[model samples]
Target: MTSIVSVRDLKKSYAGGFEALSGVNLEIEKGEILALLGPNGAGKTTLISTICGISIPTSGTVRVGGHDVVTDFRAARNLIGLVPQEINLEPFETVMNTVRFSRGLFGKPRNDALIDQILKDLSLHDKRDSKIMMLSGGMKRRVLIAKALSHEPSILFLDEPTAGVDVELRKDMWDVVAKLKASGVTIILTTHYIEEAEAIADRVGIISKGSILLVEKKEDLMQRMGKKRLRIELSTPISELPQELADRGLEIAADGNALIHDYDTRSDRTGITALLKDLQNAGLKMTDLETQQSSLEDIFVDLVRETS
Candidate 1:
C-alpha cells in the first residue's frame, strides 16, 4: 500500500518560541485507521492541522498524496477532510444547505446524490432540513461529519470526534467510523479515549511534549508492552516470602494474604513454570491464582510520565 500522507522532520513553533511539534516523521498508509493518543497540550491537533494545511509549518515538510502541503496547498488539501474539535457550524443554516455549501466551497460540482448518501450514512437524512441550532449536540456532530464527507475526501481527520458526547452516541460515532474504514477512506483520529483506539484503530501512536514516543500496530503494541501480573491468593497469610522464593523477586500484597508477580508476555520463558515449581518446593499453599493484562491506558500513562 502507498502512503497517503507523509511527514518528514515536521516542526511547528509559535511566536513565543513554544514548539508544538518537534522533528516529527510519519507515514500514513492508504486505507488504514491510525489513532493519535496523547494528553492535553501534547501536539496532537497541531500535527493534524499541519498535515491538513490548516496550520503552516515553521520548518520541515509534509506531503499529502504526493503534493507538498506548502507549495501545492490546493492539491494537497483537496484530498483531505477535517472534522475539528470545535462545533463551528452556522447556527441558523439548515443541515442540508450547510453540507452543500461546504461542497461548493471546495469547487466540487453540485452532486445532491452524494450529499444524500452521506446524510443517510450519518443518520441525518431526516434532520437534513432542520436548522443546526435546533438539533441536539450529537446530531450537530453528525452534521459536521456529513459536511466533511461532502467533497469525497480520501483522507479524513477526526479530532476528538466523540468528545463531550454520551456513551451511546460515542458508540454510534464508532460505527460510522467503522463504515468509513470499510469504504477504504484512510482515517487519522486523535482521541482521549484509550478504548476508542483499542476498539477501532489499526495502528496507534503515542505523543508527548512535542515528540512522538512510539507508533506500532495495535495488537503488536499490546503484546510487546502489555505486562501480565499473577496474583497468588493464599489460603493462609504469610509475613515474609520464604527464603527459597527470595530469588523470584515476588512481592507480598498489602493485605499479606497473597503474592504478586509481574511478567513480560513477549518472553518465551515467562518464568511462571519456575515460580510455580518454587512455590511447591517451598510448601506454600495457593488457594487461587489469576492473571491480569495491562491496558493501553497504562502503557500510555507510563510513557508520558517517563518522558516528562
Candidate 2:
C-alpha cells in the first residue's frame, strides 16, 4: 500500500533547549487507522500538529499525500482535516452554519447535500439548527467531527476524540469511526484510552519522551511482547515453593493458595510438563489451572517505564 503520510528523521526543539519530537520517523499507509498512544506531553500532539501544518518542525520532513507539509503547505493541508483536543467552536453559530462555513473556508463550492450527509453521518442532523452553546458536550464533539468531514478530506486527525464523553457517546463515536473507515478514510488518532486503540487501530505506536518507542501491527505486537502466565491452584496451600523447583521463576501468591509461573509463548519449551511432574514429586497437588495473557495496556506501561 502507498503511504499517504510520511515522516523522516523528524526533530523539533524549543528555544529553551527542550525537545518535543526527537528523530521521529513514521509512515501512515492509505486507508489504515493508526493510533498513537503516549502519556501526557509525550510528543503525540506535537507530531500531529507538525504533520497537519499547525506547528512547524524544527527539522526533518513531513509529507501528506505526496505533498510536502512545509513547501507545499496548501496542497498537503487541503488533503487533511484535524479535530483538535479542545472544542473551539463559535458559541453563537448553528451546527449547520458551522459545518457549511468550514467547507467554504476550504474554498469548496456550496453543496448543501454534502453538508447534510456529513451531519447525518455524525448523528448531528437533528441538532443542525441548534446553537453550539445549546448543545451538550457530546453533541458538540459530534459537531466537531462533522465539521472536520465537511470538506471531504482523505486523511482525518482525531486528537482524543472521545475524551470526557460518556460511555454511550464513546461507543457512538467508535461506530462513526467504523463507518468512516468503511468509506476509505485514513484516520490517525492520538488517545489515552488503551482499550479504544486495542479495539480499533490497525497498527499501534507507543511514544515516550519525544520518541517513538515502538510501532507494530496490533496483533503482532501483542504476540511478541505479550506474556502469558500459568496459574496453578494448589489443592493444598503451600507456604513456600520447594527447593527443587526454586530454579524455575515461580512466584508464590501472597495468599499462598496458588503458584504463578511466567513463560514465553514464543519459546519452543514451555516446561509446563516438567513443572507439573516436579510439583507432583514435591507432593503438591493442583486442583485447577488457568492462563492469563497480557493486555495492550500491560505492554504499554512496561514500554514507557523501560524508556523512563
Best by lDDT: 1
Strongest candidate by TM-score: 1
Residue lDDT tens for model 2, 272-296: 9999999999888889999988888
Backbone clash count for every predicted candidate, in the order shown: 0, 0
Minimum summed lDDT over a 10-residue window in model 1 is located at 219-228
- In model 1, residue pairs whose N, Cα or C atoms come closer than 3 Å (at least 3 residues apart or on different chains), thus clashing, are none
- Candidate 1: RMSD to truth: 3.9
List the candidates' TM-scores in order. 0.87, 0.85
Which consecutive 10 residues in model 2 have the weakest lDDT in total? 219-228
Per-residue error at 134 for model 2, in Å?
0.7
Cα lDDT tens digits, model 1, 1-308, are: 79999999999999999999998999999999999999999999999999988889999999999999999999998999999999989999999999999999889999999999999988999998999999999899889999899999999999999999999989999999999999989999999899999889999999898888998999887785568999999989999999999989799999999999999988789999989999999999999999988888888999999999
Q: What is the lDDT of candidate 2?
A: 0.91
How well does candidate 2 score on lDDT at residue 228? 86
